[model samples]
Target: MTPTTAPLLPPQKPFDPRTATIAIVTFNRSGLLSKLLDSVLEMEPRPGHVLVVDNASTDDTTEVVEGYRERFGDELVYRRMETNTGGAGGFSEGMRLAYELGSEWIWLMDDDVEVIPDGLARMGRWGERFASVQGRRYDFDGSEFYWQYRLSIPLGIPIPFAPAGFDDSGYREMNSGCFEGMFIHRSVVERIGLPDPRFFIYWDDSVYGWLASRLTRSVIVNEFVLKRTREIKQWDMGTRHLNASSDRYRYYIMRNRGIMQQYFRAHGAYRPALFAVGTAATFAKEIIRLTAVERTVRGTSHLFRGWRDGLKIARDRSFQTMPPLV
Candidate 1:
């Protein structure tokens, strides 16, 4: 008897930029948001729709969005939340709307970055091959953002890859990607559903990216799409780049780390004892970095409190499909 093999799939059709929806999640940075919108509008083959999810900014975010609405008319859709939903919520809602609008591809980004003129075109070129393609981000100083690397499943940390290793003709498979300049296909969204809004902030993008990787192939494209305009001061701890994040950020980091541990344990990604050890190591490293580098002990309490709450937080199975944004 002859062994049978699965039939080869047909080549994917070329992606159309006009079928893509650019979703920008903004907080109080109205000026940066406006600049980002301007850059998006200037793309040669502009996305069919630009969905701006305002996280209830207290500033003139509404005014800035209104100006863009006047210029782009219906092409720009601004949805302002009644309250701040953080990055997780904002992206979830924006993605839901984009999906409902029937966009073939949804590009997620933050207001702090500006897309290069040919960014969409480059992403479109690779759209046929990968379910999710993350473009490289350059810092304002023209340096590559080295920290935006693939996540190491066991260590639960981003592992940096050399820039020269990228292939210009295709993408390299990745386990995870950041929300910034992440171009996702509609089919991937249908498979994985939406990012868990309960995450509030930290680890949400990582979890969503990981979920997509489990269902379909996700890759990092060699082309540069976005430039991070803001400069983040970081105290390097050899392998980790510890940013001087806020107390709130610290809480989310610790809490989300716990939640992620639960996720890994449930999926058999790691043995419970091994995950516990890794968690303890992660917590210890964070505390040491905070004390030695930041010269501050203010976030210690928040860190412990977050760890406690995160372990108690329930696992959300409903993240497959996002609820409608009110």
Candidate 2:
């Protein structure tokens, strides 16, 4: 009997910062976005281009960006959306633009973060070990931000960050991603097409990262590269940190589980009963946090609304349009 196996792909060439394009997505955070743009200029070997996707900010976001026009000169490309697309849609739009520009490396981030001076250099030193590379971030108080993850597909969770995941390599495999500081090679984008914009906001990065993991090497390196600028009240949960939730967050967190389940099924990881249990636990946790931590039930209606819509979303056929694993 003869056996056949697919051939292994060769290693990609080392990463080059000059071939990179910085894609920043912002809503109305003009003050924070300006600082991020300032940091971009501070990069010793900055990316060749910077693309800012504005989700139709009513604030002086356009003016803030224009203030840096002379400094950025032709290096900056600003495209303002007609409407707000949330984080999910904005990132998708920004990524699509970067890809179409024929960029070799696309670094995705939000307006709330500023890359540490020389951050790209430290991370770039990794030299392309993984196609999708994530840099760590420091919280508003200069504390370590809890961002690393080992996603549980059926359980629908990003397990709390653990130091052991990094081992001796100073990097760890991750099946989830954060738009705050994700540096993805063009090949990963080419393989996955674009992030599912239907997500609109939540769980979008995880789904995109999951696909990247399935197709190639995806990792979060130990280097501290970003500083989160937005300050928020957070509850310390031993190793991980949870930010106070808003009604918008509550609704999206609940409703997006169904969208999450759709992609899980597309990836052959769906288990309805298990996912339902996970969803229920999530609902319980949010409710408890609402009543105890925040001491208010004002957002309860949004959670219920999102959950009701989520159940309906789980059964929708729109998921079929998502690309299959390569």
**Model 1 Cα lDDT, one tens digit per residue, 1-326:** 00123211213998888799999999999989988988987888889999999999999999989988777888899999999989999999999999999998999999999999999989988887777888888876777665455776786755544343665555677777688878898877876678778789988888778767776667887788899877776775443456667778878877887667655665557455655665676678678767766887778888888878776652554322343232
Per-residue alpha-carbon lDDT of candidate 2 for residues 87-181, written as tens digits (9 for 90 to 100): 88889888888887878778899999998889877766664566788888888999887774678777787765446346688988778888888
Clash pairs of candidate 1? Answer: 193-320
lDDT of 2 at 142: 90
| Model 2 worst lDDT window (10 residues) | 1-10
For every candidate in turn, the CA RMSD to the true structure comes to 4.3, 3.2
The global Cα lDDT (0 to 1) of model 1 is 0.78
lDDT of 1 at 264: 63
**Model 1: CA > 4 A from native:** 1-11, 160-164, 167-170, 236-240, 314-326
Q: Estimate every model's Cα lDDT from 0 to 1.
A: 0.78, 0.81
